[model samples]
Target: MKIRLWLIMAIMLAAIVLAATGCGATTGPSTIVTSQQNTGVWVSGQGKVTAVPDVAILTLGVQVQESSVAQAQSEAAAAMNAVTKALGDKGVAGKDIQTQRFTIYPIMRWDESKLQEVLVGYRVENSITAKIRKVDDTGSVIDAVVTAGGNFTVINGLSFTIDDPTDLLGQARELAMKDARNKASQLASEGGVKLGAPLYINESGGFIPIIQVPIARPGIGTPPS
Candidate 1:
């Protein structure tokens, strides 16, 4: 009877030890699964597409100098009026004409004889931006401004851009996605693991307008940023 009781106790202790060992084995696999779920590959890609621009934006202005502020302002207004009329005559819409800046400031010059700075004159500047729909007529519009404002007229900047870039953007996005997938695949292969399905995707870039303005002449203007 005592032998039987001892055998039963030994069996129960072995079963308890086996249960503890089994629990520890299960925990290791659970930790590994949690780590895998929290980790993933990250990468970025870039794409570019070139297409002919269909629109032009022009920044032109009038600057006048005079002995008094009132005189300078008057001269600037007259020049700007003529410039607007010229633009209207060339088919530019009123809504397309935007006033970018208008200012009147005094100019100072160093009087070497007096050894001090002195007020010389006042200067007035008025800047206007015009969006030209007919790209081919850009040269003629520039000529019109020059004829109206003469030496006071300054072409500050010009830029060309694609009015509708939907197709180009789609193509660029596809290329970027492919680039990312390729990089991820290469990394997975080198690491001796099969690439899993992508758990997340994000777009990092969008269309950037072209700024190169094909000027008909050297004095047209520089491109804006």
Candidate 2:
């Protein structure tokens, strides 16, 4: 009788242990499954917009070649000085006129017969960058530079820019966000999914300078409208 009682106790203990083990396993797996089901899907979208430039910058220079370095440099300097003076006379501030490039290089004459090189003359170049706050005066400034002994070959043309791009960039970002949301909504509708609040938002776009045709002039003329 005692043996049978001990055997019954052992069976009950085994049953209890098995039940506890099954409960622990089920609880952990259920928690993990719930977490996975609650996870959301990620979607992405992009957009772009055009903005008109508000400022114009022009680069102008004078290049002169002469028999000697001194002569070439002197001529280039005089021409550049005349150009700057003309700009100042036309209400360009001293701060706005900046010297961008000044170079003096030897003009090499290659001799094929002797396999030698000779310095025939020297070439001097001086370039100045002018930030014209008034876009209307860009053409006029070029004309003025030409009239002020700025020879034809050295006049590099104008480049357009935005003086303050901060406001425009902000507007662009807002537009981009709107575009992304619209795209997401359309996609969700097509896929038969409810559009949820954005789990993540990533915005990326930049302003690029639009280039205009460079005007070439043998001599100065009326500003382009």
Candidate 3:
């Protein structure tokens, strides 16, 4: 799927300096310096890049409930092991499979006769975050994991993103600079001034991932491990 890389930069403006000997006024931030003495108009600009996602991230796990903690843990462990193996068989590297959570908690039920809650059994959950570098194989990988985990499979969520955003960020930054300069030029022209050079530029940027949320997310009362 298509993903976006958005970038914005702050091109601060300062007062223009008067030229000597009938020379032109100094340029600032690739546009004519604002001569408004702290009353200059503030311009905002953004540069965006659209690209295909190179990676797929999956949050998946296995959960089991049994009358005893050991039984729950054993079943959950076997299912999770199979899930990890399935990920590997689907070309996911070992380094990409990371255990995110493992919890065992009492499954409680209300005892109407005693007017108190009693532990009927225990629930064990084991989850992992796996990264699939081959984005095209995401669907097959998910299928394999689900099949391996069987009835206890829990697909928390999935997301698509760039593995390394350094290059994309650099490209976006260049575009943002160009966009800012263009806007600055427009402002200068409207204010009846010639375009000059840039004076101050401060760049800030962030990345947003494209996520495919599940229709239902499991409640998170499981104890952390």
Candidate 4:
């Protein structure tokens, strides 16, 4: 009877140990309780605007070729000097007129049939780049250069630019932000979610050039209105 009692006590102790160990084991992941918080929507947007150009840039040059390098260089220099004087006479500041390129290169000729190479006369080119703050005078300036012995053949077309781009870029950024907000709101409404504040914002600079339009005047009938 005593042995039987001892066995029974041992069995009870083992059962208690198993129960304790089972309770100490790790539990499963806790449940994530979601409330009435709305889901966020993402969006991207772009904006563009046009503004008139306030400045003009002109590139003018003279090219001369002669049998001797010195002669070629002298002719190019003389033409460029005349161009500079013309610009000065027109009230263009010395700071605005800048020499952009001055080069002297040997002309080359090759005969494909005979496989012969020949060195022709040297060609010298001198160019100047000028920025004019007054856009209205751009055409007149080109005319002056041509009349002042500057080879009009070397005159490239004019390019237009804006004097200040900061204000324009700021306007573009504001428009971009507004567009982004509208897009986000629209997406949220369609997806049955809520729109939140922007997580990020980015912007880029913008500029548009003015293009000249050519018009021909024939016998006018109602001016083609």
Top of the candidates by TM-score: 3
Task: Report lDDT (CA) for all predictions.
Answer: 0.66, 0.58, 0.69, 0.57
Clashes of each: 0, 0, 10, 0
Q: How accurate is candidate 2 locally (lDDT)?
A: 0.58
Error of 2 at 11 (Å): 73
Per-model TM-score versus the true fold: 0.70, 0.70, 0.77, 0.68
Runs of candidate 1 with Cα error greater than 4 angstroms are 1-39, 186-194, 212-225
lDDT of 1: 0.66
Candidate 4 — worst ten consecutive residues by lDDT sum? 7-16
Candidate 3 C-alpha lDDT tens digits along 78-115: 88889999999989999999989999888888889999
Q: Model 3 residue 36 lDDT?
A: 34
Q: Give the alpha carbon lDDT tens digit for every residue of 58-140 in model 4.
A: 77777777777898777777777887788778767899998888898887778577799766678887778877777777667
Q: Candidate 3: lDDT of 12?
A: 26
Steric clash pairs (candidate 3)? 27-197, 28-197, 28-198, 29-197, 29-198, 29-199, 30-197, 30-198, 31-196, 32-196
Candidate 2: misplaced stretches above 4 Å? 1-52, 111-115, 217-225
In the range 39-82, model 1's lDDT, one tens digit per residue, is 45556665566666667788888888887888777878888899
Better of 2 and 3 by TM-score: 3
